[model samples]
Target: MTYNVQIKVMPLKDLLDPQGKAVMSGLQNLGLSGVEDVRVGKHITLRIDAETEEAAKQIADEASKKLLANPVMEFYEIEMIN
Candidate 1:
């Protein structure tokens, strides 16, 4: 069976996101003062062939840990899409 996987990769909370900060600064400069605590992240979607949902999830997790995300500065969450 084929399963759809969604992965979200983001900077660790303790890490500094220069791009996010720059975007926030740009927002403020554009007069959008209500925006605060901006952060940037990546969303990835893929399809995998697996026998079970659990197996699909494991595959997605492994992909995230091994190739999709940077373990040092980023973390990833995987979701199974119906």
Candidate 2:
């Protein structure tokens, strides 16, 4: 079977995201107010062939940990889309 996986990688809460800050600054400059903060992140989609959903999830998790996300500065969440 084939599984569709979505991975979201984001900067850790304790860390400052320069890109996010820059975007927020731009938004404010554009007169977009009331936005307290912004955080930038990456969205990854993967198609994996596996026998079960759990297996696909494991594969996605491993990929996220090994290559997708930087553990020191970022965190990742994986979800099975199908």
Candidate 3:
């Protein structure tokens, strides 16, 4: 089976995000106010070949922990679309 993978990688809640803060400030300057606690993240899309959905998920999870995200400061979610 083949699966389309969608991964969202974001910094852990306790981590500080300077880029997100900057964006929030920019938005306020643009007249969009009252937005607080904005966080920045990354989206990764890929395709994986596997025998089953479970296998695909495992592959994505392993890849995420091993290389895609830093387990200490970041977390990841994997979505498998058939």
Top-lDDT structure, candidate number? 2
Local accuracy of candidate 3 as per-residue lDDT tens digits, 1-82 = 7899999999899989888989998999899977877999999987989898889889999889898999898999898765
Rank by lDDT (best first):
2, 1, 3
Task: For each candidate in the order shown, give its overall lDDT on alpha carbons.
Answer: 0.94, 0.96, 0.89
Between prediction 1 and prediction 3, the one with superior lDDT is 1
Judge candidate 2 against the unseen true structure and give its global Cα lDDT, from 0 to 1: 0.96
- Give Cα distance to truth, residue 52, candidate 1, Å: 0.7
| Higher-ranked by TM-score: 1 or 2 | 2
Query: What is the RMSD, in Å, between candidate 3 and the native fold over all Cα?
Result: 1.1
Error of model 1, residue 53, in angstroms: 0.6
Of candidates 3 and 2, the better by lDDT: 2
Report clash pairs, candidate 3.
none
TM-score of 3: 0.91
Of candidate 1, the 10-residue stretch with the lowest lDDT total is 30-39
Q: Candidate 3: lDDT over CA atoms?
A: 0.89
Locate the minimum summed-lDDT window of 10 residues in model 3: 73-82
lDDT of 2 by residue, 1-82 (tens): 9999999999999999999999999999999999999999999999999999999999999999899999999999998885
